[model samples]
Target: MAVTRSLSTLIFDLGNVVITWDPRPALPEQYTGQDAEDLLTRLDFFTRNADHDAGKPFAEWVADLRSSGDAEGADALQHYVDHFDRSLVGLVRGTSQLIDDLKAAGVTLYALTNWSAETFHHAQAAAPALAQFDDILVSGEEGIAKPNPEIYTRALERWDLDVRTTGFLDDSEANIAGAESVGLTTHLFTNAVDARAWARDMTGAAGV
Candidate 1:
């Protein structure tokens, strides 16, 4: 018979889970609608952004774009970087309350996120609730990103968290899968309400 471990710790993913991240809003007004989408696609924005999250400097990425004759894309990326704060629209609705409830219950909280090292400060300033976390492991700082088993392993090891008692929540299915691969209890976060319910049930938090 296997003993079930009570959930006492939670690992959170920042983007889309705790805070919303959308690059479209960071683009120039002229790049609105399909044009913005096109720009991102043409630049392979997601891929490059992932690289940035892995600690590749944005200046180097822009230089690479310029060298590839995508000066327009390069310029656009620079502008987006300059106005990165605009991309962190706001905290996900209900997340603050959920975090507060969990904190009050003495649940251990930590954040694991894939964000550029250069720009993560913007998110810190934007979301006051982030301070509730006992600690945050940033991909850009570690040169590793989610959906990679290594980072999950590192987080668990670094935090001295037990896989059986620690729960991981992420908006991205890929990230959730990564956590699961490492034997963690996982939650696919669609909304704060569902997430809060899951946390409450798992942790048996009082008044949560």
Candidate 2:
């Protein structure tokens, strides 16, 4: 018979998994529908945002846009910075309860997230449940984003966690793959209910 190791520690991904992020609301009212889609395309939003998550300052990005004769894009980016709080829609449904239950059960908890250092405060302010984590590792702060094996290794080393006993929960398939590469048990989170079941099985925590 094979025996399974119980997960004593859990590393959670904040975006989507804990906090819901929707940039649409952050745009000016005029940039609605196709205008919004076009604006994002013009600015290469996702790629540039990834650079921000990897520690590139927003000012630098805005400057680059301005220099490229993209004043509109630059202003929009600034607006996003000024009103970043609006982008954090809310907490993922049922995650706060799960976090509370896990904490009550004495499971060590930590957070690993890909987020801009300049704007992470918005998420912090919006999600009170985030305070439950023992620690949080932000990609922007570390200058290393997810899907990078080094960050996962750093998380393990920083927390003195045994990979075999730690489980990682993330919404990104790439991030989950990275955690698996590091030999940590992983759950690709879709919703809190499924996550609760996985947590219960891994931790044997009652009422998870």
Candidate 1 vs. true structure, TM-score: 0.96
- Across 55-104, the per-residue lDDT of candidate 1 in tens digits comes to 88999989999999989889999999999999988889998889988999
Q: Taking the tens digit of each residue's C-alpha lDDT, what string does model 2 give over 133-161? A: 99999999999999999999999999999
What are the models' TM-scores? 0.96, 0.97
Model 1: pairs clashing at backbone N, Cα or C within 3 Å:
none
**Residue 55 displacement (Å), model 1:** 1.2
Q: Record all residue pairs in model 2 with backbone atoms less than 3 Å apart, i.e. clashing.
A: none
Residue-level lDDT for 27 in candidate 2: 86
RMSD of each: 1.7, 1.3
- Model 1 gets an lDDT of 0.92
Q: Pick the candidate with the highest lDDT.
A: 2
Q: Largest TM-score belongs to which candidate?
A: 2
